[model samples]
Target: MTKPVIVVPKGMEFIRDEIGYAPAVLANGTLYIAGQIGRDDSRQLVTDKEAQFVQVFENMKRVLAKAGGDFDNLVEMTSYHTDMRDLPLFMQVRDRYMKGVLVAWTAIGAAQLCGAPGYFLEVKAVARID
Candidate 1:
């Protein structure tokens, strides 16, 4: 069996070294992306919920791109939100990026995340490339 390849998109140095986790790992035609939050290049959390939601998707897209896949390749996703009340907004942002891509998803409410302060949501995804 081939070894898993850790995918580290450009400009994700902190996530690779400081955070000690690969943004995604590719193996056996599948890519597993880690939970992505709304932090910008500087690693500062965005304050707006809508912005955060968009950033999460954008971050996932970056990982997918690094793995030679796209949104259409995504098969499943799981999201953790600090507030379930933001579901409608989350869905709206999701649709903006997902468009015609069909993916199974699950969302759960959580009291907090690893980095709380301004962070509200985290999204993890799985993609099949073959």
Candidate 2:
């Protein structure tokens, strides 16, 4: 067994220092990314639904980049939504980033999520760097 490399992007010290979890972990050429919420770099949760969705993906992208991967390297994704009805808009924003790159994705409806009340979406993912 080998120790996993913790992936923490620049200026994201809070992921380990405050939040007490690795943003992502790299082991055996695979990156396991934790749930990404709508918080901006300053940690303020985005209120607008559409913008929040985009922010979540941007957060995920940052983690992936820190792990030396990208959306195209994604192998699986699981998204939790507080309001399932927002699926249409969410997919629109997701597709803009996905850009035809397909992965095993599961969309789940969560009652509530994150530290803030308005953080409606959380996306967790796995990607292969090899």
After superposition, the stretches of candidate 1 with alpha carbons farther than 4 Å from their true spots are: none
User: Residue-wise lDDT of candidate 2 within 1-130, one digit each (tens)?
Assistant: 6789999998678989997999899998999999989989888889999999999999999998888888999989999999999999989999998998899999999899974588789999999997
Tell me how far the alpha carbon of residue 39 in candidate 2 is from the true structure, in angstroms, after superposition: 0.3
Q: Roughly what TM-score does model 1 have, to 2 decimal places? A: 0.96
Top lDDT hit: 2
**CA lDDT of every candidate:** 0.91, 0.92
Please provide TM-scores, in order, for all candidate models, with all chains considered together.
0.96, 0.96
Q: Write the per-residue lDDT of candidate 1 for residues 23-90, one digit (tens) a residue.
A: 99999999999999998878778899999899999899999998898999999999999999999999
Which residue window of length 10 is worst by lDDT in model 1? Answer: 111-120
